[model samples]
Each structure stands twice: as C-alpha cells, then as structure tokens.
Target: MSLGDEHDGASAGGGGTGQTRTRLPDSGAGDVYGVYGGARRPARNSRSLITVVGVVVLLIAAIAFANRSGDGDGDGSSSDAPAGRAAAPTAATGVKPVAGKNGTIPSGYAHDEQGAQSAAANYAVALGSDGMFRQDSRHAIVRAVHDPAVVDGLLGRLDTAYSGAFLKNVGLNEDGSAPDGLTFVSRTVPVGTKVTEQTGDAATVEVWCTGLVGLAGEGSTKPVTETWFTLTQKLKWTGNDWKIESSSQKEGPTPVNGDNRASTADEIAGAVAGYGGFTYAR
Candidate 1:
C-alpha cells in the first residue's frame, strides 16, 4: 500500500519527468469497427506503440503525447514515409540486447540511446523494491544506481526520511525487517519503457510498472495488493554507465482488474520466494 512517500524532486528542489495498460470494456458482440466506437477503437490507434512496448518491456504511452501518434491532429504524415500513413514516432523506437551487469542490478550500459533506456528500466525496479525499505540495502542501492554527483544529496535526504515512523507505518520493524511469520512484498514488474528524450550525454526515460506491495502471511492486516505506476528517471552517462540523476513517479493508466481469485497469504509468500524476478532492461 505505502511504498513510503514520493521522492519527486520538485519542492525538494527539480528534475523528474509509461508503458500503460489500457482497459476497454469487453464489447461482447456489439463491437463495431472504424466508427470511433467500441472496444476496438484504441486497438487501431495504439497497435504500433503497444506491440513494440510489450516486447521491449514497456507500455510507453507516457511519451505518445509528444509525438501525437494517435491524436487526430496530424496531417497524416510519418517521417521519411509517404503522406497519409503516420509513422511510428521516433521516441518509442528502442534498441535491444541490453548488455551490462552491476551486481544484483544491471550496469555497464553502453553510452547510447538503448543503454539509457535499459538503465532507466532497471533503476525503476530497484527503486520500487523491498531493498529500499532497509537502511543498509537502501544506502547501497542509492549509491549504486544514482549519479555520483547527486548520491550524497539523495542519501542525506532519503536516509533521514526512510527511518522510524515510515517503516513502522508499513508494518515493518524500525530496523526495516518484517515481523515473524510475515513477509513484506514490494516488487516492481516493468511492463514497458520509452525513451522520451535522448542526447549524447543525458536521457529522460519512463518505465511503466505494475507492483505488489503489502504484507503476506497469516493474520496480516496489510494484505498484498497490486498497483500500477510510471517512473520517470533522468539518467546521465557517467563512468561508462547510465546513472540516475533524479526520478519521480505517478499513478498509472491502469488496466481493468482481472477476474482471477486472490491467492492465500501463504500461497503468495511461497510463490514470491520460489519464483525469481526478471532482469527487465534486457
């Protein structure tokens, strides 16, 4: 529920900036085509971005606003293509084979557009993870994923804010560990990513993610639940890796809730422990 408070660096100071699932009511048999009505309308508009994003590990709708891909304002032109056929916006275009490793997280990204994107996706998982709840792990993660220039600034602020009342509020001990028989669930699964803006030295990337947060186990009041979010990270190419300069998040373009039954607490805990998470950037 509370993965703690937001760290958006606006009032705290500056710099912050989806892949998103779209839910359309099942039109049953009444669905119509090309009439701007029915569940199929968005299907026509978002095919290019949605398909590409799902494969690349992003819903990338966050940047669609810039290119006006589906917005009916275009003269019906795609760059370097014939008129009347809208081209895929360049921002949603991405590179593949994320080649890098950094301990638990991926590091050593190339100094290019693809590398910047990979960096942003991986960082989103780390920032939203259970590791951020613990002081030691949080410190290491902050140092590992952040730009060296801003690391101290973030630590100085985050370290103070992440302690005491917050942990207890989330049902964790003051030291950041869960109580006996309970497991804290805080994992971010990236659905899609987009390179909103890129340059030789810096990049702004958005990662669309679905997360599970809460306590899983018997007699727990905070049951595990799902949330959808988008994380925008500003990355700098430094030390041969793309490191985060600043990041922020917002609630998502959530999909309709599914019909699947909720799992029991023990079942959730077992599944979480038995299953390993993904290396999202690649």
Candidate 2:
C-alpha cells in the first residue's frame, strides 16, 4: 500500500519563517474532519523568543523524565500517555512477526504486544488508504483487518463515509477513480505505535501517522495535502490472529512545522509512481 512521494525540505525544523499550506475541503463522513496544515510565521521579538525557548526546554525535560519513570513494571497500568507525551519506540523490538497476508493486508501476526502494535500500524495504513474508496478493495481490506462480526457494520458505515460527494470533494470520480490523466493520492505513513493495554486475547494500540490525501493532477483543485492523526484500535486475537475489534481516531500529536519546501504536484505524482510502499513489520 506504499505510494511514496518525494518531498523537498519537509522537516519538523526550527520555526520563525512564513509557511504556506493547502486547506482541503472535508471529504468524508464525520469521522474524517478537516484539518489545517502548519503555515510559516514571522520571527518573534527577543524577549518573546526567550520565553518560548524556556517553555520548550522545560517541556522537553518533563517528557524525558516521564519516559524514564514510566511504569515499566509490566503491570500494564498507566500505559496511555497524555497528548504530547506519547513517543515512538526508539528501537526495534527484534521480535519475529507475521509471515504473510490475508490478502493485500498483513495477517497472521504473533499473539503478543509487538504483534498487536504491528497489526494496529498496518491496519491504519489499510483503513486510511485510497483503496477504501472502492467497493471491492474496501471490502477485502475490512475483512482482512477487522473482526468478522463487525465487517458488515463497518462496510455500511464506510460506504456512507466515502460517499460520492466525498469523492468529488477529494477530486475523484463517483466510482472513486481519478479522472483520466490524473493520479489520485491517499496514503498513510505510520510514525510509530504504542500498546496502551494488552491481555492474552486483546490489546489496545495507538498509531501515530502522517498522511497525504487529494488528487495529483496539473489543474486539480484538491491538490494533495498532509494530515496528522493518531488511530486507536482495539484488537482481539481471533481466527488464530489479531483483528481489529473497534477503532477510532483523533487529530494529532502533531509536530511543529518543518522548514522543507513543498514538492510540486508533478513531483508528487512521479515519486508515488517511482516508489512503492512496504508491508510494514516491527
């Protein structure tokens, strides 16, 4: 499900310059809310800058202390951090993982914490993909990623979520295809995942991700835009593997604006075509 885009100068860098960001129309049901991208700003006065720097230093110190003091006792309490405190696992767990896919989506994950985290990450990619706009692919993805009992309910809800109006708003045809000569863009890139709770049969995971959604065509009105979100999925061990029992999403643990220059539409399309996505594993 990887459709890579090359970005010029995109980074969560030190700020103080003006930035231009594209605002997309709302494209789906209430689940997918409109989000504003970070814009550049003018530098602040010296006194204000000093205050900001002081606050940032204190925040960084607080976060470091929290992580070190986190309840690593394996009792699974106090696992979910407050907003802005959840950090990505800095190192790989080196655990053996799922060996195959149920279809295009990964399946057969190990029945443990790392497996649950990996399942949640990959499911975020599948559920937030352009494939969800099409019936066949959407059904396959839901079946592959979600618990069987909830598939029908989710499909119907998702059908309404990605309505014709939503498709049109995002620069797709009624059938969810890009018009001739245009390439639609919808991708989710997970930054990392955390398991908030776990048991022998179930786990709760949060995936922090950055995404791109819109159309990549020369004259497209809904040009590709980026979004930040955290997806929380409740997973259950089912059919000898992990499946999503329920899911919800929220806006972000969005990082500060990066100073990288945005790539052109043509560059985006070319990069997506040139680079393929991965079947993510942890």
User: What lDDT would each prediction earn against the true structure?
Assistant: 0.59, 0.61
Q: Clashing residue pairs in candidate 2, if any?
A: 2-277, 9-260, 10-260, 11-258, 18-40, 19-40
Error of 1 at 175 (Å): 0.9
Over the stretch 15-132, how does candidate 2's per-residue lDDT look in tens digits? 0010012234443322232122222233433456677788889999987986786535342223343345445452234454567878878777767776788888887777666676
Question: How well is each residue in 65-135 modelled by candidate 1, as lDDT tens digits?
Answer: 55564344322111231323323333323444445556678777757655666678777677667776676
Report the Cα RMSD per candidate: 12.7, 10.4
What range of 10 consecutive residues in model 1 has the weakest lDDT sum?
A: 32-41
Clashing pairs in 1: 18-60, 19-59, 19-60, 57-192, 58-192, 58-193, 59-192, 78-87, 101-107
Best by TM-score: 2
Query: What's the count of clashing pairs in each model shown?
Result: 9, 6
